[model samples]
Target: MKNVILTQEAPAAIGPYSQAIEANGMIYTSGQLPIDPATGEMPKDVEAQAEQSLKNVFAILKEAGVDGSNVIKTTVFIKDMGDFPKINKVYETFFTESYPARSCVEVARLPKDALVEIEVIASNNKTNIK
Candidate 1:
């Protein structure tokens, strides 16, 4: 069975979609932008935006009873590839030694004109439990 996950800790979905969903012991999160759930504002810089986006993703994971270490795969979308290094710096802090598989790409644009966004898939398996 599948369960829909929602939390005010993360930004509200702007459309007809859940923030994340859990099914068969796994959690799938939607693309997270830099909007601060508390303030409903987007950070100005790419680095700050990246940090906010990661935090948003983590909030969803926490809402689903998981963490960054539980994540198995992730997809990062940036408006400019040149910002990869900056984003990576903040992104690396979230995970430990065995980092999750990830794909980072520069897209033409992103929702809300945010500089960066992230989506993650995490597992609730024994091996990944913290």
Candidate 2:
């Protein structure tokens, strides 16, 4: 069976998609924008944008009983490649020394024209991810 992951700590999905879904032993999260769940606002800078995006991704993982350590892979989308270094600095604060595999690409634009967006695939370590 498939389990839907939802959390108020993360921003709500803007389209017809769940925040994340878990099946078997894996949890796949939708691309998370930088919009803050509480303020419904996106930060202006790339560093803050990356932080917010990761926060959203983690919130979904938290709902599914997982965390960054359980993440096997990640895909990041950014509006400008030049902002990569700044984003990386913020991203590193969220993970440990042994980081999950990641791929980041420069995109022309994001959903809210935000500077960054992120998504993750994590392993559900517990028996029940309710």
Candidate 3:
């Protein structure tokens, strides 16, 4: 069975999509923008934006009963390649020494003109919950 994941700790989906979905021992998260769920506002810089985006992704994962270490892959979308270093710095703070595989690309734009967006795929293999 597929389980939809939702959390108020992250911004609600603005369209026809769940925050994440779990099926077959895997949790797949939708792209998370930097919008703060409390204020519904995007942060001003790439570093902060990346932090918020990852936090949102983490929240969704937690709601699915997983964590960053469970993640196998991630995709990062940024408004500028110039901000890659800054974003990477923030990204590293989230995962451990064994990092997940990642893909990052410069995008023309993002929802709410966010500086960064992140999505993750994580394994539920350890807990075998649902």
Candidate 4:
């Protein structure tokens, strides 16, 4: 059975979508904008935006009973390629033990004009150390 994941620790979905969904021991998260759940505001800088985005993604993962090490893949969208270095630095802090396959791209725009957005797919299994 599929399960819809929700948590107050993360920002509410801006549209008609669950924060994440889990099935068959896999968890898939929707792209997370840098909006803070408490403030409902996006951070002004790319580095901060990246961190917020990761925090949001991990919050959903946590709700699905997993952690960063469980992530198998990641997709990051950025408003500018020039800020990749800054974003990468912040992204490094989140995934400590193992790195997941990742794809990052520059986009013309993003929801709420966020500087960075992130989403992840994770393994929700016993070996993942939730």
Candidate 5:
């Protein structure tokens, strides 16, 4: 069975998509923009933007009953490659040992002109404390 995940802790989907979906013991999240769920605004710097984006991703994962350690893979999209290191620093705060495999790329643009966006895939077996 497939389950659609939704939570008020993260920014709502801007389009016709669920925040995440779970099936076959795996949870897949939609790319999360830096928009704050309460303010509907993005932070100014790459570090803050990265943090917010990952927070949104984490919220969805939490709603699906998993955590960062359960994640097996991730994909990040950024408006600029120059912000990679800054974003990576924030990324480290969210994930620990046995980090999930990830692919990050610089893109020409992003929805709402967000500086960073992140999505993840996680197993539903266990949760990790952040």
Candidate 6:
């Protein structure tokens, strides 16, 4: 079975897609930008932007009934490679020892010209409960 997840805690999708989809025990989330859900404003600095992006990802995860620890993989897109260290610092604060696999890449540009965007995949850990 496939389930679509949505939450007001995260910014509403600006296009035609759900925030996340849960299927067969896994949750796949859309790329999350730094838009603050409360104000719909992007943060100015990379660190703050990264933090907000992760918070958006977390909100989608929570709507799927999962948490950060459940994340199996993540992909980060940054407009500039120079901001990797700053983004990594904030990203690291979210996960612990069993960190999820990740890939970070620099793109020429992104929707809304945002500095960073993050997308994630998580599993329920419960094989029989999907």
Best by lDDT: 1
lDDT, candidate 6, 25-78, per-residue tens: 889999999999999999988899899999999999887777898999999999
Candidate 2's displacement at residue 73, Å, is 0.3
lDDT per residue for candidate 1 within 21-124, as digits (tens), equals 99999999999999999999999999999999999999999888878879999999999999999999999888888899999999998998999999999996
Off by over 4 Å in 2: 127-130
Q: Number of clashing pairs, model 3?
A: 0
lDDT of model 6 at position 71? 92
Q: What lDDT score is found at residue 6 in candidate 1?
A: 94
- Cα lDDT for residue 52, model 6? 96
Q: The CA-based lDDT of model 1 is what?
A: 0.92
For candidate 2, write residues 18-127 as lDDT tens digits: 99999998999999999999999888878888999999999898888877888888999989899889998998999886688999999988897888989998889854
lDDT, candidate 5, equals 0.91
Model 5 per-residue lDDT tens digits across residues 7-125: 99999899999999999989999999998899998999999999999999998988887878899999999999988999999999998898999999999999998899999989988
lDDT of 4: 0.90
lDDT of 4 by residue, 1-130 (tens): 9999999989999999999999898899999999899999888989999999999998888888788989999999999999999999999989876689999999999988888999998998847643
* C-alpha lDDT (0 to 100) for residue 14 of candidate 5: 91
lDDT of 1 at 82: 93
- Cα distance off (Å), candidate 6, residue 82: 0.9
Give per-residue CA lDDT, model 3, range 13-66, as digits (tens).
Answer: 999999999999889999999989999988898898899999999999888877
- Model 2 clashing residue pairs (backbone): none
TM-score of each: 0.95, 0.94, 0.95, 0.95, 0.95, 0.94
Cα distance off (Å), candidate 3, residue 118:
0.3
For model 5 the TM-score comes to 0.95
